[model samples]
Target: MKYFCLRLLLQSVSWNAPLRTACSSQTLELKRMKLPSTFQESSKRFVHQVPATEFVAFTRSFHGTTMGALALTSEERFHEPFELVMPGVTFVQYGSIEEAKRTIRKGKTAAVFVEPVQGEGGIYTATKDFLQALRTFCDDAGALLVFDEV
Candidate 1:
């Protein structure tokens, strides 16, 4: 009776056949690559060659799907409402540090994803004060500050 019950329990659990097949066919390869110990350490040495726009799109997709909507810049390009592609993402104008602060304070933002240097968005760069203010605001609000450095 115990054996039968155990078999039934196992059968009730759903199995991912594709995942199992892929795992069985693939040979795991472990490769070592050097990475900085911390974000500060990495910032000092590394400047990603990949355009920040690419990272922005990737970030949008990731956050949009995984975490529902996101707090984004108010730039026209990012003004699209939540839909099939960008489910819950909303773009709010991040014109100034004060404006950003107000928006974040008002909303239950999961994270504030921004590019320090706007690549496609007129190549504008965030000032030191602005960046610092954002960091502080996010810290205070208990929201994540995601910098799309790429």
Candidate 2:
């Protein structure tokens, strides 16, 4: 198609016409192009034990830490080295359809957590298709879709 445009330009046509045609073609090409997602990393989870070990605390296990709740905390450094985390939590790559499918298929998963806009993971929003695929996977595995909205 580009070659055809060049041929038309070389013929006895007005230069303005060919220039407009080339510009419109370029716009169409640009529209066809797609850019990759900027954010594509898993959110980290950190767990901590309670500080108080009193008689009541032993059973109840009250906790103390500078670290805030995991749902809305935007800083990864606050939970650096992610200590004593849960064993079964699977953090797949953001926007990774294959990894999400595999993790969901493991059959023991309790919940599939996701954020529509990953505020901590560089403010990355997932594609609709990716989210749909995850929804399907979670449904098949009988897992809950925990949308961790931040």
Which candidate wins on TM-score?
2
Model 1 TM-score, all chains together: 0.45
Alpha carbon lDDT of each predicted model: 0.37, 0.37
- Itemize residue pairs with steric clashes in candidate 1: 52-150, 69-88
For residues 54-84, write the lDDT of model 2, one tens digit per residue. 1100111111232212211223343333323
* CA displacement after TM-score superposition, residue 77 of candidate 2 (Å): 5.2
**82: Cα error in model 1, Å:** 5.0
Off by over 4 Å in 1: 1-88
For model 2, what is the alpha-carbon lDDT of residue 142? Answer: 52
Please write out the lDDT profile of model 1 over residues 1-150, one tens digit for every residue.
000000111222223232223223223222122321133222212223211211111222222212122213333344344244433344444437767776664235445555454545355555656656766665565554454332
Q: Which whole-number lDDT from 0 to 100 does residue 92 have in model 2?
A: 63
Rate residue 78 of model 2 by lDDT: 35
